[model samples]
Target: MKSVVANYMISRKWLLLALVILLILLPFVLSDFRVNLLGRYLAFAILVIGLDLLWGYMGVLSLGHGIFFGLGAYIMGIHLKMEASSGGLPDFMMWSGMTELPWFWTVLQHPVIAILAGIIVPMIIAVILGFFTFRNRIQDVYFTILTQALVMVTVTLLISRQDVTGGTNGLTGFSTIFGFSLSDPATQRVIYYVTLGCLVIILLICSRLINSLFGKALIAIRDGENRLRFSGYDTSMFKVLVFTISAGIAGLAGMLFVMQVGIISPTQIGIIPSIEMILWVAIGGRGTLIGPVIGAILTNSAKTFFSESYPDIWLYFLGAVFVIVVIFLPGGLMSLGKKLKRRNSNEKGQTNSKADYSAS
Candidate 1:
């Protein structure tokens, strides 16, 4: 029976069913506020899973995922604003002294366009960035720094364009998504479920991608770039493709976040948040697909709990957790759990050995 359960977990369909069941039942068990917060975390998990594919599997450290996420949120925000205004100007535009919606905002009248842009804009940006970076054979610490630079550039641009991009304030007051009134509890729950559904879909796609030939190639590239290149792989193209896919996933996460939170801002896409994102991937265990999801959920849950209980020392707690994870369990929380179980097994083995010796 135990083996059967284990085998079921190893199957994607069963794993997905289990995840869906947990998510579906969560709202029943959790308070509205907590359920909503989990919705936000689910969005973050999507981004983390994508990052794990690139950084964990492909060894491509990206610090600009926040930019992609922010882009998607902003795109969705435009559509939400349009939905609220009914072909009029977003309130922020009026407040900023604009007589009419900007020309770029025109396309936002169509939800389909906004959704497509959310996916495409980030992908295009990533492809452009990857083209230059990968072509130059950038990797490791240098690539990380480049990604950080990308985040800084994006944050700076958004902050500088107050009238256009809402500057540091960014886009907000998104009162609706589609035809649904976001203020309604039913609509909010529906959005939450939609986010949960997206999470499950992304997880399955990621699992499949990681287990397929393409996934093997990515792992190979991570393990030995030179060998992969020698073996006739167009490594740069692979990097570009994977990077774009990662950015697009981040965009999807951003859209889900904006739907739940009703806001998008430069602060949310800044360097600090980018660093925190990498931490999610790290503390989750980079190479393992499930590690990032675990890390995001656990870290976010800890942050929520600690901030409410001891807001003054929450940063210290986060720091302490990072330090402990780094020092004792370099592979991450997942590895830490495995280590404890292994130690218990070793101790039990020793006890059994001693018992047998005594009997002899």
Candidate 2:
């Protein structure tokens, strides 16, 4: 236990150093477009981490995370539109034949309410869904299918409501965020930094959370719910709590994503996008926290690169990457590190045994 703790401490310090270097150098090395791409990826990294908390560690395969993400994005998008119009209708609103903003749009005028909604809406939904689902002991692929259905239902609702949701076009033409002109390079950089800071903060929070007693309980449930239940732990409540945490984190990521991308649409919350989110965690390695973060960054970065280079073949390229990761790197990139560590440990043991044999 002492050795494990010490190794974790050292690894954390190293990861911290890596984050510092990336934040310092990334903006200068990348062009504005690339920086924006990275910003979006960083936001998704938060989402992946949140997904990892529930699906990766707790054995919950959620295909509905995109819905939570979209909810948060929509909240932030409304606020951006409100700030741009200064309490009037957004540009899309004008194009859609709406002369006046709705009553709900009034709350968006305040950034605080918008931000709170971004976090709270997802949490509320997750809590409600989780309460019934966990209470009924629904899990595994059954839970995943239900989640996918929820996303489909939400997307259908959003698409059907043309006036309020901007219909298929889905909320665009945002002017500012919290008084900062998003179009300005300075503002963009500030947003990027804020995103990086958020990624770091979420990483730390998750690390601590996973190491706590609550985290241990979730792992217990993940490994063997029957045993945990027998041991007097309320497995269902633990699952609900973890699920809610995952949803909140996804919401946070969604808010950051809308700020950078300047739009939120039904397409983002649809079934395909939700599956892609799972791919992000799967390709990165589900059980390891760091794996999801690395996976999101690499996969999204690759997507940007591929789309820019060969727009026609980017989807195929992404598909191939997913196939390759699933086949060869079942543990994700983080597993490679673990494999190397074990190999090194074995070599050291052999060397120590040989030295002792010689002394004897």
Candidate 3:
């Protein structure tokens, strides 16, 4: 038994190592377009892992992550827009007959400040939302509903406030970033690697977080919040912290995504995107950190492929795939390995028992 367990662990290590190597070599092996697509998916992976931490471990499902993601993307997009404007108002603003930048937009004029706000703004929003909701002990379905509602409200506001937010079009027309032309293929490849590096960093942080006592508390709250509270732990605080951290991570993903995608629109942050984010976590096997990453990549890749090949039916195809995964594999894709291992172990045990019976 010990030998078998040891071998399994070793195999897992080798598998992980191979995956890392594959990711590192992908840019070299694939076309620039494919590499960019994978890079965008990597950004989604970051978002889903954070969602897993919140919904999978902490037992809080938030459909409003799209808002935090949009906040970060918009913040970064605003910076790029400002730079593109070059000491003048953005094209959208000028077209709308605005003579000056909004005060909020002005705050993100500096690249460094924009980056900071890209991350920090989502966290601040999370803290405010988490504090109020968790403090009131409003969780589970109510929390989920509120998050979904927030997405609606946020998208509506952004669309309605066209002069400030670029309306339904969101923010685009980014020419350069940090003096590097975005249209340059070399610059794009560099961005792709940077995104991959960020994904690694976020994974490490989440892995460390889950292995710590805080992670245990999160699982505990997920399993039995009232019992944890009865034991004198501040469950609300734990919930709030996890939610805030996850929001910040989502924000970081947004910034990376905007760097590659070149657009941040209200349509992207609307209800459909929020639901898709949740599906990534669910289909990936939420509690397992790596599962969500895999889920995000696979699902988004499928979306890209289908949208390219079968644009008219891609949405239906994606929906059908998720439905199948949920109905048949509720434990998710990660659980398949465990199931197979368990079946093998059971077969071995039965064979041993039959041999003993014959000997008797």
Candidate 4:
């Protein structure tokens, strides 16, 4: 089994290397607009990876990942808005009739604090949620429903707090980040590279984690939580740890997204987008690290193309794609590729065996 796994990795390594090369070359070859889109898609890819880790490995489906994502984005957004306003009220705040910066927003003026809060805040939320849910033995559909409710509550709160959160508009108009003008092409390129680097780092970390004994424990929990519990493991603790890590990763993705997209809104943190995040993981093989990245890029690219070409019919097309993937390609596109490769290898072996028999 180890040998087979090693061989599989060896076979896939070239493809991984090619992908890295393509990412590195994309900014150089594509127009600025296209590069920006790629950067945004990469951010989504990071979110999908975290979702895959949670749902695919641990069997803990969360439809509320957007809350963590939005929290992180808002943290960075607050910092950028504060910076842009030069320590005064953000534009939305002024428009909403705010006289002074909110006390909570003051400490986030420091970029370092904002970034740390972006990651740490989400993890803290995840820890609290996980503690309650897992301790109460919530799993499967109940857990999923709870997450859905969480997203709804978060969106409602953000939308209602017009003065504090900018309401429907959220936050935007970030001119510079840490002294670099966002409008500068060089700055955009640097941000794109930084996002790509972060994605790669997160992928590496997840890859190592999933291959470890802890990852095996996660799988065991996924397969049989009760059995694992009976085997003398603190399954709740594991669940909380994995869930917090997943939220932190999502938060990191949100920060990268805000840097590239320049806006963080409640709309993006709502139920539909959260569901789309799950589709990204499912359409890619969930258990596979690279699959979610491919799914995110392909699915979002398709959505962009279809929505541009046929805005009214894009939803039907997307629904059909989801249906077909669920019905026919249950293991996802990556699994299909693996199946084809194995079939071809088996056929070649059979042909070689026939030739040997003929020679004998």
What local lDDT does model 2 show for residue 328?
69
Clashing residue pairs in candidate 4 (N, C-alpha, C atoms within 3 angstroms): none
Per-model lDDT? 0.83, 0.83, 0.86, 0.86
Expressed as tens digits, the lDDT of each residue in 1-360 for candidate 4 is 577668878766666677878999989889998899899999998888888888878888899999999999999999999889899878788788889888879999998999999999999999998899988787567878988999999999999999999899999999999989998888989989988898888888998999899999988888888999999999999998988999999999999999999999999989989988888887887777788888998899888888889998988887887788777776677778666766797878843222110100
Each candidate: RMSD: 5.9, 5.3, 5.2, 5.5
> Once superposed on the true structure, which residue ranges of model 4 sit more than 4 Å away at CA?
341-360
Candidate 2, which segments miss by more than 4 Å at Cα? 1-5, 340-360
TM-score versus the correct structure, for each prediction: 0.90, 0.91, 0.93, 0.93
Report the lDDT of model 4 for residue 186. 86
Which lDDT tens digits does candidate 2 get at residues 1-360?
A: 578658867885697678657865889988998788788998999999989999777888889999999999988888888887788777767777888778878876788988998999999999999888888787567878889999989999999888888788888888888888899988888899998888888888998998898888877777788899999988888888888888998999999999999988898888988989988888777876777888888888777777778998988877887788777666777667766766797878843222110100
Q: Per-residue CA lDDT of candidate 3, range 1-360, in tens?
A: 678657755664566567667889999989988998999999999899899999888878899999999999999999999888875799888889899888988888899999999999999989998898889788578988988998999999999999999999999999999889998889999999898888888887887888899899998888788999999999988988989999999999999999999999998989999989988887887787878888898889888888889898988887887788777766678777766766797878843222110100
* Full candidate order by lDDT, most accurate first: 4, 3, 2, 1
What is candidate 4's local distance difference test score?
A: 0.86
Candidate 1 lDDT, tens digit per residue, 145-219? Answer: 988999999888888877768777778776777887888878878989988888878887988898899999998
